[model samples]
Target: MQKYTVLLLINFFLLLANYSSAAANDSFTLGVIADCQYAEQANKGTRYYTSCPDKLSTAVEQFNTLPLSGVLHLGDFIDRDFQNFTVLNTISSVLNTPLYHVLGNHEFSIDDSLKMRVPETLHMPARYYSFEINNWLFIALDGNDVSTYGWPKTSKRHKRNIALFNTKYKGHEDWNGAIGAKQLKWLERKLNTAQTQKQPVVLLSHFPIYPENNHNLWNAQEVLTLISQYSTVKAWFNGHNHVGNYAQKDGVHFVTFHAMLDTDSTAFSTIEFSPNQLVINGQGRQPSMVLPIN
Candidate 1:
């Protein structure tokens, strides 16, 4: 009996060690789509060539190749029509990898259809949520971080934008770059826990959180103040102000993909991470570069 018990213990320890080694070497790829507005047709009665997606369908088809660890669309999945349930369901269900979204102002700007309904079938869950995968944490924010502005129909512009933002964002004061008290508090708690565990964290939102984000967070200075306090927070990703723009702030790199609606067409970004470095590259636009760890 003693000899049998000792053999069992040895086997258990070996299996545990093997599991740890396998997990350490595992890596993954992710696909990012920003501003698809799939529900709306291109060249919608308006002459606003400045913003639109002519090649969104083709790009999404490419992502369907699906080997991605997962995929995320930063925001603006559809335009002014939450009732475009068909589009929402099609893409959400069709994507090969699990899909996550960062709510853009357009998402809240629910227009004529279905009247900006909340708790719909398409939405996954609460606005703020995070996930742990392959031992890494990825956080997705409901709204923007800077100034915290939204799609409430306060004015003509807000009225148009509210087609999506009005659901919970209506009656709420608009913001251009402020992380609201609620989100900031939540973020603090999350970041503290991450730091305590010595785990790396990646942040995602529709608007920019860093100076390189183009539009500054309502109080970017304050956001940075909080970030500087934590060492575990690694990269912040966002996709709000569209393409023809890119910036890197402090150690945080702000990446904006080419607008799916524009002539620049569809593009994808790949990030390769190692213990010593994180590499970022874009497919259709912007010259790729490397950031060495300091």
Candidate 2:
């Protein structure tokens, strides 16, 4: 009986050590691209709209060579033309892995009658939704939910957005936008569930929420406060500002990637998440950074 008990104890210790080592070795890489803003227009100021297709093709070729679990476009996949969506589709289809998209203001730049088709074109389940990948929750938000530029001028939501912009934001601009009340509630529920499940979260939005700027979401402060309530949120990724920015608050990392539209060169990155740290491997013009996970 003593010999059997000693063998059982040794087996249990060995299994425990193996589990620890496996957990430490677990990691996943995610491909990230933002503000592709593809269009067949001449260069306007800093944005080279006509050059995005070649840039996207290059990005897709690079991503295909990488061992990424999935790819996420932080939005502005096209500029202001509905025709550009077809070009985007052609360029992005070369990606061999799963691809996800978040809606940006440019998605609604078409006529109001065709605005509803944008989501379907991008293969998004909804304007705002959540998905799970390797024990992490990714939440994609629609910042254009209340934008004057995105919503139809005759619609009540557009009027409400204008009123809010005038009164609350002091008429910031039609380019800026906010998440609606329903979406806010949905986000809260998702965060609560993630907390209960002990899952880490990576939030994706088209508008910046931190390091306040003209391109930030209209209700950015509210969104920031809401996210800070949940400890499970590890990072927030965004675009819209185009210049790119980074900040950390209350244990969450806010990272904004540069717009692919700005230059003739490409801008994209792959992010690897490990047990202890998050590493961003930038390609083209995107800047790399290493962030420790809490």
Candidate number with greatest lDDT: 2
Write candidate 1's Cα lDDT for 1-294 as tens digits: 999999999999999999778754655667776666554445644222324333445555776764567777777676656665455666467666787777676665555343234324446566668887666678887554322234333445444444433553344445443456678889899899998997777787766655544354544566678876877777777766665355555565555554454434455565665444556666664345564433
lDDT of 2 by residue, 56-164 (tens): 8888898899888899999999888788899889878888998999998888888887787888899999989999888899999999987778777888888997887
Query: On a 0 to 1 TM-score scale, where does candidate 1 land against the true structure?
Result: 0.71
Off by over 4 Å in 2: 1-17
